[model samples]
Target: EAAVTQSPRNKVAVTGGKVTLSCNQTNNHNNMYWYRQDTGHGLRLIHYSYGAGSTEKGDIPDGYKASRPSQENFSLILELATPSQTSVYFCASGDTGGANSDYTFGSGTRLLVI
Candidate 1:
């Protein structure tokens, strides 16, 4: 199995609350990504990191933040949770330099804003 794990598999918070989703990947991949899965937009990237201490904005970065503290850990933070932000967030790790850069996903974290 892929050595990736996500914390707090489910969460519920009041509007304007803060929510943090954590992930740990033991695969040692150079690239880590945070994505939110929604109804029609599909899986949209929220943020990504190439390595430790590096984070880059993704296609849909508004209202989202990411942190890569080390090669094995990445965190997704929602400073102000809103109902519109409720969705399933997934963390994936991959090394794009290889011939076949396949990603391994952590168990998604489902968040609900009330």
Candidate 2:
């Protein structure tokens, strides 16, 4: 089964501060993604990578960046944190079959900006 895990279950950040959220996967899948979940909105993709050393912007990549240094690790970087960016972030991994394939998501990282 594909498994994804994220660090710092909860975080509080000051405005304009930088924050890095880490994710690790055990399934060795080629696709990894970062998404933020907010009330009244569906999970919006922030970034994704097909494999290590490759990161592509997603639907909501404005305040975020991503890095994938290896098959098992991916990180989301918030260069300038803001209250608007405060939300639950989830990391996911899945097969390359697109929508037909189910993605396994992490527990989520709740970020609170002050």
Runs of candidate 2 with Cα error greater than 4 angstroms are 98-100
Candidate 1 lDDT over 15-111, as tens digits, reads 9989999999989799999999999888999999999999999999999999999999999999999999989999999997667578889989999
In the range 1-114, model 2's lDDT, one tens digit per residue, is 657889989999999999999999999788999999999998999999999999999998998989999999999999999999999999998879858458889999999999
Single out the weakest 10-residue window by summed lDDT for candidate 2: 93-102
For candidate 1, report its TM-score.
0.95
lDDT of 1 at 47: 99
Backbone collisions counted per model: 0, 0
Q: TM-score of every model?
A: 0.95, 0.94
Name the lDDT of candidate 1.
Answer: 0.93
Q: Which stretch of 10 consecutive residues in model 1 shows the poorest summed lDDT?
A: 96-105
Task: Write out the backbone clash pairs for model 1.
Answer: none
